[model samples]
Target: MNSLEKQVESAWKNVDQQKDTLISEHSHHLQNSVDEELRTLLQSVRQLLDDDGQQLEKDVDKLQLIAQQFREGVEMWQQKAQSSVKAIEEKQRVLSLLVEDVSVRTEGRRESLIQRQQQRVADTEDNCFRVLQGISS
Candidate 1:
């Protein structure tokens, strides 16, 4: 080949090499962009999962606290009920003693009244007998 043909062939080869290099670089850049976008999306998903997990933990803690409070309330109410029952039993015992005392006093009063009535009847009978004897004599 002549010198001009050689130069022309060399120029064409150079142009072809530049075209191939540009296409390869563009493909690499597009792949990098897609990879970066996928990475960003994955990071967002991870953040959301972390937030949800934290919220779930907080909710579990709140539920546990409420359960503890409920248990305490039930125990306190049971104690109150026991104390109330004890108070009522004491009152019942006191009332029983009062009733017994009242019954004894009433029985004593009835006996004394009966004795007085008998003595009065005897005195009236003696007076009547004396008056009848005097009249006869």
Candidate 2:
């Protein structure tokens, strides 16, 4: 080859090497950017999962507390009902005793009234007999 052709060939080789180097550098930068983006995406997904899991746990705890409160309220109501029933039974027993006492007192008063009336009737009969005898004589 002549000198001019040799110089042109050497220039072409230099341009090819520079092109390859630029391509390799661009590929490396692209790979690093993709890796960084993937890491960010994975971290975001993990955070979301953790937040959802914690919220689920809180909801479950609230449900359990509500259930326990419901159970305690029911138990308290049952206890109140039992106490009311016992009080009512006691009142009923007292009322029954009062009725019996009143009945006995009323019976005693009736017997006393009857005895007094019988005594009055006997005295009237004796007076009438004495008056008839005196008139006949």
Candidate maximizing TM-score:
2
lDDT of 2 by residue, 20-134 (tens): 5765676567557655765675566556756688776665566556656755675576567557755765675577557667867998999999999999999999999999999
Q: Kindly list the per-residue Cα lDDT of model 1 for residues 46-135, writing each as its tens digit.
A: 566566887766655665566567556655765675577557656755775576678678989999999999999999999999999999
RMSD of each: 45.7, 45.5
Q: What is the lDDT of candidate 2?
A: 0.68
lDDT score of residue 40 within candidate 1: 72
TM-score of 1: 0.57
Off by more than 4 A, model 1 = 1-51
Regions more than 4 Å wrong, model 2: 1-52
